[model samples]
Target: MCGIVGAIAARNVVPILVDGLKRLEYRGYDSAGIAVHTGNAISRVRRVGRVAEMEAAAAAENLQGTLGIGHTRWATHGGVTEHNAHPHISFDKIAVVHNGIIENHEAQRQQLKALGYEFTSQTDTEVIAHLVHHYYQGGVSLFDAVKQATRQLSGAYAIGVIALDRPDELVCARMGCPLLVGLGEGEHFIASDVSAILSATRRVIFLEEGDIGLLTRDSVVLHDKNDQVIERAVHVSDVSLASLELGPYSHFMQKEIHEQPKALSDTIEAVLENGFAAGLFGARAAELLPQVEGVKILACGTSFYAGLTAKYWIESIAGISCDVEIASEYRYRDAFANPRHLVVTISQSGETLDTMEALKYAKELGHNMALSICNVRESAIPRASELVFYTRAGAEIGVASTKAFTTQLVGLFALAVTLGKLRGRVDAQAEHGYQEALRQLPGSVQHALNLEPQIKAWSDKFAAKQNALFLGRGLHYPIALEGALKLKEISYIHAEAYPAGELKHGPLALVDESMPVVVIAPNDALLEKVKSNMQEVRARGGELFVFADLDSHFSESDGVHVIRTPRHVGVLSAIVHTIPVQLLAYHVALARGTDVDKPRNLAKSVTVE
Candidate 1:
């Protein structure tokens, strides 16, 4: 969930490493640090603060070097302190900046302490530095030392290392985490993400599992587990630099929330032109979709919520049994292996380590027909899957996802309609009607965006409340979960969601005047049931914030605030309802003075379990 950037170049790379970390600031970090191989020794500057502080400290120290590794750390092993920051050192011989957990760090730390290696930081990453130093003391090269140290480690990691003795070379490796080698003119870079080093190089080699890379100023040598040289495809990242800029917006969350319309349109452009078919997922999807009898969706966080919403559409409309499992939990349990069941993985950044591991676990259980719905076209999950669908929600920098969630719904809905048609669940006319509705999806979402002013005004009053209850019924219940997730993620308000029918089960006890209740009451089959639940809240003096359809006839009253979304669009109402919900969360965060773009302890991509 942290960020890593290493640069080997002829010119001073301090600025490059620093700027890379700044670009990656959206990935959420509590501390920032950098270690540079100076003229004769490794110089380090670690700070328990933002990138700007680290940059200033580096400037004060005149930390000039042609090669360095930098990190923005999300605290994992220890407390958020300078002592636990990255750029962990080992007797000043080796410095490592790592992203992801080292599962067996305690064992390594004990062994290292026994071997007379002193530790300065309380971090799993420090074990890596010490282990590499221990191996290098045997007169082995840094590359072999890193490889040996990595062999003893268990768990996901992407590490960039610099040795004082090997200032000319930087060794990096990845195991179950994303770490790419960026090829530049007379320079080489290693970063956990392509966006971090986009300024220095667009051409990158995405390392595979157990891949180790040795980098110099002018060349990069990659080797697989057996020490045999390997070659992976070099992908030219098309992430425009402008996409990273906030432009007129105050935060990335705001920009991404408003960008959903175009993002949704682009995701379904191919489907809109050629009609919804199994081939839209992939050329082999037609062959695979026909063989599917059930579906198991594995995802995490916002992507998991998207899967929950998709389950309603697939089961109700496509007439297929669907199950949504948290990717992190999927590996812990023994799944009922069924080869005929289609395994679908959803992720905004295909590099989410938990979901990727779940995908591998699903494949191991004889479920080989895997499909991925992801935003990044060249991400690992899509590459690993037999079938893939891109969300086209380009470069989501916000830690709390907006466009990515809505766009994933678009892809999932398309999959539902395609499956419905193939299974005879939907007739030709019904399929055509679904297509027409999809064609207007972008416009419908845009119309929902128009409710932002109303939502923002309501947020001024809602932000004062500390707890909230988001209620919906049937198809809209997942949306209520999503709405609650958004409010708690960005606004830091305690929020919970429940099926409207289950309000009296337990959640109703928490509702009172101090509690704000957000309800999704579209004019679906259960609109009356949802309205009854709203009355239940209002009768208890619980303030109500409702996002209802224009046809629902919901209006503002004493302690009740209503924002009119577009007319209900059936299962697609979930998509339209998401916009106002997102806006409310964003504006509430603004009112509460919380970090909307990078929420506390949350990373844009969950690359660690």
Candidate 2:
């Protein structure tokens, strides 16, 4: 993913474009560049590092303009170099910054070369600049040229363009990628995300697919695919600017890890207030929950692990057959679709491309009932689904995803209890007990947060290790997978997870003193089996790091290190266990001196396939 920003105003827009690029830096940071319309031509500055470098260069050049567009690139089509950085200009007239892949860029590049246009950069985004320049010839306006170029492109994209000829105007379009138009007095802003321009304006209009936006200093307009003027409602974004700031914290990942208690509390309180009824999902959830013959979940990355955790609860607590599929893989395969099966999609940013496509594919296969569990409001997945549940985790800035994962589990747990009650799988007393346990989770999570000191110490040992093995059973197996995922994501350590029962089959060969084995052992029915697996690792002279409960009775020894949880958190232990695991990954990354918030080659949101 790449970040894109554009601004048109009566005052100099250099600082505004730079600040917007800074806010969007989390989306991409490999390279940065900007194009500003000067008196008679476009002035450009490109750098192969963070936006700060580009800002320094722009200041040195005294780049000044009333209209501009900027970009921070993640380098999908080219290497990280000054030449590959965006704000690709054509004939020193048309400048463009773009996000998402252009599937037919090679073909377009060949045709542009035949038409006598020279290329300066090895990027698909350069094609947009050349194509726009080609169409803007023979008296075509810049806005109409951009609209015409969009019709010839394939794949997802969000492009922002500016021309020296039309210095007071900015033209942008989106197809399958996020784009927003921010409203301001005598000024307007365009960005890949609302957070990038929130300082300029709280009022925003989310541009749908195939919609083109025209922004000027005094007016904003939207045009549909057929060149018809369209009216869109302006939404007031409630996300506070303070949420994006890291106050008294060294890194965003650590801050998000510490914020888990409040995040879980916020998510769970919504369910407690609503009494865990089917209506908690939506008004039609009561009618939909009772008619479900099976449950199918589609998700990707950390969200997929959350779905794996829900599969255990849905089957054991709700007495329903559940299958969890990776969204990217699910979209390409024949699903053996059944109309009676309920399709559920999970995503932190509801705009994840693979998950959104899978939701569309499921709907195409005759599934009438669809549900979405997401954190973002009005994202594509929620709009495409029939019912929706929001995880009130606020803004998760860390690329590794700390608070969003735990909050998704909270929502899934609520869904499990609600389905259990409706299907006669859980009695009234048991349902009430589940509710009481949920209410106590906020305090219990606080107790889990207290273990960070010891986790940080354990991370010292982990920082030196090159590999790790995580072992768990039943519902906790998914948590082991999540723990392993977190460690590898930020720490860059090679890690793997296996169901404890399968240790003797194959994973045991990798166990030794050099390979640390992390175990998730809560006092559940499968605890004994997990303990035996731990013994197998110990017998093989493997170092064991166990995250257990007070009732689990696991003790520290020469080869084993035990950190007990507050207590066995019935049914919700998966959510509690995730906290310490996240802390382990965070601290280990710190000890290893790796980038915790923005891991290498990873984007916070996977908006491209």
lDDT against the true structure, per candidate, is 0.90, 0.89
Over 1-609, each residue of candidate 2 has an lDDT whose tens digit, in order, gives 778888999889899889988888776469999999988889999999889999999999999999999998998887888999989999998999998889999999999999999988888989999999999985788889999999889988999999888978899999988888989999999988888888888898988878998899999889987789998788999888888999999988888888888888888886778777888788789888888878899999999999999999989898888999999999999888888788999999888999999988998989888989999887778878888999999887888888999899888888888888888888979988988998888888889999999998998999999999998898889999999999999999999999999999999999888999999999999899888888999999999999999899888999999999989988889888988899999999999999888889988778889
- Kindly give the stretch of ten consecutive residues in candidate 2 with the minimal lDDT sum: 20-29
Q: What is the lDDT for 599 in model 1? A: 83
- Candidate 2 Cα errors over 4 Å, as ranges: none
- The Cα RMSD in angstroms, rounded to one decimal, for candidate 2 relative to the true structure is 1.3
Q: TM-score for all predictions?
A: 0.98, 0.98
Tens digit per residue, CA lDDT, model 1, 126-204: 9999999999999999999999999999998999999988889999999988889999999999998888999998999
Error (Å) of candidate 2 at residue 100 is: 0.5
Judge candidate 1 at residue 377 and give its lDDT: 72
- Model 2 has an lDDT value of 0.89
Q: Candidate 1, residue 351: CA error in Å?
A: 1.5
